[model samples]
Target chain A: MAELVKVVVDAMGGDLAPVEPVKAAVEAVKERKDILVILTGQEEVIHSELKKYQDYPTDRIQVVNATEVIETAEPPVFAIRKKKDSSIVVGLKMVKEQKADAFVSSGSTGAVLVGGQVLVGRSKGVERPPLAPLIPTAKGVSLLIDCGANVDARPSHLVQFAKMGSIYMEHVVGIKNPRVAIVNNGAEEEKGNALVKETFPLLKEAEGINFIGSIEARDIPAGYADVIVCEAFVGNVILKLYEGVSSELIHKIKDGMMSTLKSKIGALLVKPALKQTLKSFDATEYGGAPLLGLKGLVVKTHGSAKAIEIKHAIFQCVQFKQQRINEKIAEKIQPAQFPAPDKE
Target chain B: MAELVKVVVDAMGGDLAPVEPVKAAVEAVKERKDILVILTGQEEVIHSELKKYQDYPTDRIQVVNATEVIETAEPPVFAIRKKKDSSIVVGLKMVKEQKADAFVSSGSTGAVLVGGQVLVGRSKGVERPPLAPLIPTAKGVSLLIDCGANVDARPSHLVQFAKMGSIYMEHVVGIKNPRVAIVNNGAEEEKGNALVKETFPLLKEAEGINFIGSIEARDIPAGYADVIVCEAFVGNVILKLYEGVSSELIHKIKDGMMSTLKSKIGALLVKPALKQTLKSFDATEYGGAPLLGLKGLVVKTHGSAKAIEIKHAIFQCVQFKQQRINEKIAEKIQPAQFPAPDKE
Candidate 1:
């Protein structure tokens, strides 16, 4: 590896914090020699757990002390301010200070959304920053944007969401000229709520992406569209429901397999393939969602996340580095009249 | 089987029409001896297809002639007004005349939503008839209400949606005292758009239902609650995402299995268990959304529905009959001196 890509992780956030995320961070170091992970939490507690993974390169694994932690219930502004040494706080600061190339957190979703905006700031010229998550589609995975990072979203915001989402899916996920769709109640362009109705025209007029007309939610799973776009509120529901339904179905499938002897035999035979398939569908494989439009990359994992999720998150930084997705996003949003970076 | 429940199907509607739906109806008849189907369409088309099913009960299968077919693109109001001999018009009339217990259609969603409201009308004391669909959940399934029938839904409408959705889940789906919740951005009772924030108190204060605060879309499949209530706009997105995610996962699983020899073996063993489990997750098994609050039962099937979907929709009528779901809904909403359905 040319130079180890550094990723700062919020070790205090998430339900299984420090332990699970720390485990993943160690696992990632073992798997990817080029990845240097800095665990940000209360230094004493984090180092105690780090002792379990002695094989991890001492030079590559460092612990940055963060004494405070933002709880799930605390208000974003209050938590980020009061907990100056919080995992999210110190982790975000690492990216802002160029001490880390990326920041990953399985913490307060509200805190992440706020801190990503207030601390890191949006890329120059971007009007609205969107939260984009890779959603499973028939064509593999499509990036769904605005899953509640912004509410009462405007047309321009959606257009920006489509563009930024498109870039991420193309560069990171490896889909070419992804088909972008504005989620709608109907397939017709004239259909959908006020936001979709206005955004339809702008998305059609957008230059950089493959703008597919309105996509109805029912057709969403039939592997219909590539990059599905919507406001944060709508996107949140789509993303959550998608995850919920996937897990529910998987559980039910396991239940059915255990229902009969013949099926049991068949299930045993297909266990490997089924497991592989389920893994691909697992969202954690892609790490956490990237709060796009930030100057530096800030990815948010679920607060209830465990160690494997953290490991995947650190690995994600490798791809983010390979792509320079942050720089591209900055250029696309701001289109520098003068090449500007690291400016206040 | 208690005397076969007869369902009047609007054969003239739907994309594949009398062929696919007829095939499905025939299959349904074979599967259940308690179903007597009345296929309404162009007499010639119905008989020609029926001839293929020699096992079809000659006395049980009745053909009701309706020559005009209403296309989805047509104006819903115009079709309801002008298409007197249209399949939808005839079917609604049959329900109105009590000749059929329920009318099933895979035609235009807009037309169905409108016709169900205008033709069937809302039951006494119902402010507005909402659409409710049973969506699969880990613990079984949850009903999503106002999934497209009311785009501009008010808080009071949603309050009614919660109560009515709870009742349907209890009586029809056989869930006991179903948990009802409004789909919102967060689980907090204070969260969501103006509609949710304002309407939550109403649902909370309302009697005769288990109002379990708010549920986020992601929590839905986790079976966090029994009745997932929201306006048509949000409901539409939830229902579609539910379908899309499942379909995408299934497709990915199928593709993943074919990737390698080892996986293929695993796929074979797990296929039966997967299928049995996957079937329960299929939205098609749940029939269609009922245009609730209507004076009569009007079921809307998937726009691209085939015969099996239609048969399932017809079966919904049987549950409606057995549970007296409507009567219960009416009683719950109109407690003798309840105010009008709208607090808007």
Candidate 2:
């Protein structure tokens, strides 16, 4: 029998709270029999939400009592330090203790980032772990590393991002020797801010990855590279802008379609096809960004994540565990003298 | 009547070169009489293209002979140094020598930035000159400062961008107060990179500008601020990603619309409304980015700028001059001992 991947989820995190997270856990266990979910939150709240689901298996899903909830606005480091029994902290501790294979959260990004590093810990030789998300592109999806963490990254940090992004895309996403490119203002080797200029040559010489040279931001949507490497500031801007532009475009398109009766009828006719096409560009369908280089997997989803997104994030951990991605990452990074986590 | 705004057009710059530049100059003179354009390029080629336009006022337009062209791939500093007879250099020289009120080019961005700082000179007290362009947003347009120039900008540089961008938006775009916001991953004052963290407090205390707090990229398109400030790296990424996402969405929309006869008919019916709505989002309709803080105006249009964009860029100088923007800029900048050019 295949080994069941036990995933710990922060049930009280995100805007939707235990409702979405708890419901998603039930759905996740139902959809995949080879997975077990540990929902961390106030047991009654989680149980109440789970009771709404009639057919989900009760055995595969369990709730761990966590009395505190971390709000989105709270300072991450301080919140994580003070709220020991918070869902986010409890969930991460489970992973740290090797009781859970992966930890998933739609909580405060700052809290998740800080808690993951501080509690769950870093894999050996990893310097400044980054959050890598799959962004939709015309061809398929590309991983944007350091999306919201490590804003002030060095050239060496970006090289690690590139290597980690390549590893994630290859094993989990199934792209072979993924094409890696550093984000810059222009495609030329010498054109970029100091970080990119320093990192470009290093990316070209880095082994085990296909360095495709610099990619202009304008070329990112065309899926020019499988792995897009950048400091967190650039990556965050791109990710947020991508969401903003997509929403604005969609809103504009709908407004245009509803302006007249003729176009309204046209909108009706084109609705299905347009929806299908836009579905391919939806980031939520692809799960959340994994804060790579951590000892145990820590995935951070949107704070507004719903049941489906949370469900997908839970399933993403299964594949991550089955593929033994952390081992691959440990190999990519240079050996450091830090104590390694005990193997299962 | 109104003081004639003497504008220099780089007739041999951009992909369309002498043809589009010459044609736009003719169109500008015909459309507005209070403007004189001095075209710089290989004179014979510009003249040949100019000859194609009939019934244009000949007296207001003049051509200067320049024998060289700066290709897009050439190193900017070297090109500015070696290609003194190039159109970019000649046009900039015209602005520097006070023969022209402004210099407009759809050439190599690097050469224009380098040439603008070296030839046109910076305003007194300006730390670094920034390229500010008005980007189309949901409500209206917002100025994006430091798009490509000053990539590794200091906190003081961003403060200047905010000040200059606010001035441009108020006078040229004609918005009052022109709320300025620094682009960041999060909207909080403390949530930013090292550069933004240092710039945030300075922006809050900056004089002569309306300072808003940090703006996330997602909020930028909603026209949350009239002036969006950031270092060139972040600005360029936002601008390019905006283009890339818009184009991809458009391409996908067209593909969806053409997938079947029903949607195709729908596409035909919705074409007019869609086209008009999309046109509003076009960046070229807003004209080129002005390399602000220069003693004389230096505007760098897209390399792919067409005749209409060129005409618009030339006419933009008219409003800039008529409004006495440079004098306002000079006053805003800290006083220096450099001799001010005599205002005609």
Candidate 3:
């Protein structure tokens, strides 16, 4: 067997907490012999959950005691600093000390982001570590970078996003020469806010990436680009609005189907095919968002994540380790690759 | 009949050009005896299309010749300045001269915005005129202000947006003490970009408006706020992404319904009820985006608008005139209603 990829799972994080994370860790180990999980949380709670599972390799999943929990409402930087034995902080520290290859958490997004940066640290020469999530599009999934990581981002930050996003899509998502585009109000080159207008030309001149021009939000769901780049503010709105509109639309459609007896019968006939079709667009199936450019892989799943998403997030870390995404990011984001820093 | 509300129809605009605009003007005059339309375009083309509709009241619809046309690709400021005899310019001039109560167009968005500001002009103390469109929501429609008008907006500008948006929603849409919220990444007051962070306190303190705190994009489609306020860049993304996702999902559902023979039969049964249910959520049914704070109303319909949308936009002007929305805005946005200007 190949060398095992050690991934630290935050068992006390997210809405489902120890039960779902422990379940997922057990399932992941049973499915893949090339990976092991360090389940971090309260020792007794994790052990109690683990008892429900049987016939798993005893040594593959280990429980690491963590006495503290970082609530989602806590200030991220303060929590990371104060809650030293918290599951999120402990997991990240393990990665920082080189005891684990990756850290996966569905805990407080802010805490995870701070811990990922302050604990695991940024890869050398990487200016900002972005959270890039694979959002489902009509053609396939497209990577939306900087969704909630950095707001008020400058032109230089966006250019780096394009570069890093291209690397992630090409290696992990397996898209060859992924087309990168900046989100703008209009398709025209001159049409954007101040930041987008400044970044458009830089993206066009950037090296080692397939740089497509500006993409309007109307073209996003049509899968017009492989990697969508923007500041965290616009990117967050796009991500959440996509969720809002889809759920609202689905609810409306179901209401329509149930309004009449004829359509009610039709609903039964159409339910299976529609469900299968929509399954391809389910975001959880794609796993967690990776805080790219970190020294060690750090994945942040939804706070409300279930067992399947946690399992997928763990599996995702395995691929990130196997493909050596960090090394590639470090090589691509070297100081020599970028222009001189902008003067304030 | 009541005093006639004269509206200038831009006959030489949009994808459908004189055809749809002329038909809509004739239809408008037929449906409402208290309105007159001044059709501005190349005299021959306007007359030619007008000749096709013989049953309309001749005196209620008059053609005013405009020799030039402004294409959508032209730079807005330059086109508004140089295109002296363009239909957009002539129609806007008519509103400036008080020859019409409103000007409605399916032409270039840029030209309409520039012309609305330069020719029709802003009301006293109105810092920036925002383009406010009523987007369909789960409950009803909500006004999304500054959708494409202002970028890199300041805190003062957003405060004005809140004031103007609240006025428009209350007077036009009939929403009383409408809940106003700034678009933010999170629900917390402290959670926002620089612009939103600065504007949040000002909005809460601003008088003459119901100020709710920050709203995430996820809550927008659920009708969480009656007036959704943001800078143009974020607002544009939300508006366009809403369009993109809904269209794509509708397309996917249709594809799924035809994937199997059983579903094809089921689709036929579900078609009528689904269509009826979806129509309420149709954006075009809500009419055009009004360039608020202008001396005379200017409504911009979609470039690809058909007769129904054109008719709705025209009727929307009637309501604006009847409700005196512009007068109400001027009163609400007086200098006394705002704080002192920020130092540069």
Best by DockQ: 3
DockQ (Cα-based) for each candidate: 0.52, 0.77, 0.82
**Considering only chain A, what is the TM-score of each predicted structure?**
0.91, 0.96, 0.96
Sort the candidates on lDDT, descending order.
Answer: 3, 2, 1
Error of 3 at B98 (Å): 0.6
lDDT against the true structure, each candidate: 0.80, 0.89, 0.90
What tens digits encode model 1's per-residue C-alpha lDDT throughout A1-344?
56889999888889898889889888888888898889999999998988887766678888898888888998887898778888898889888888888899989988888888888887887878888877655556678888754577778778888889888888887888888888888787667776677789878877788997988887776656678898877888888888777877777777877877766776666677668777867777667888888878888887777777778777777888868998887667644354325424
The better candidate by TM-score, 1 or 2, is 2
Candidates ranked, most accurate by TM-score first: 3, 2, 1
lDDT of 1 by residue, B250-317 (tens): 77767777777866776676676667778777777778878877766889988778887888887778
TM per candidate comes to 0.86, 0.96, 0.96
Off by over 4 Å in 2: A336-344, B335-344
Tens-place lDDT digits, model 3, residues A35-93: 89999999999998999989999799998999999999999999999999999999999
Between prediction 2 and prediction 3, which has the larger DockQ?
A: 3
Tens digits of per-residue lDDT for model 2, B135-222: 9999889999989656889987888788888888899889999999999888777788999999998888777899979889999888
Query: Model 2 Cα displacement at B303 (Å)?
Result: 1.1
Decoy 2 TM-score against native = 0.96
Most lDDT-accurate candidate: 3
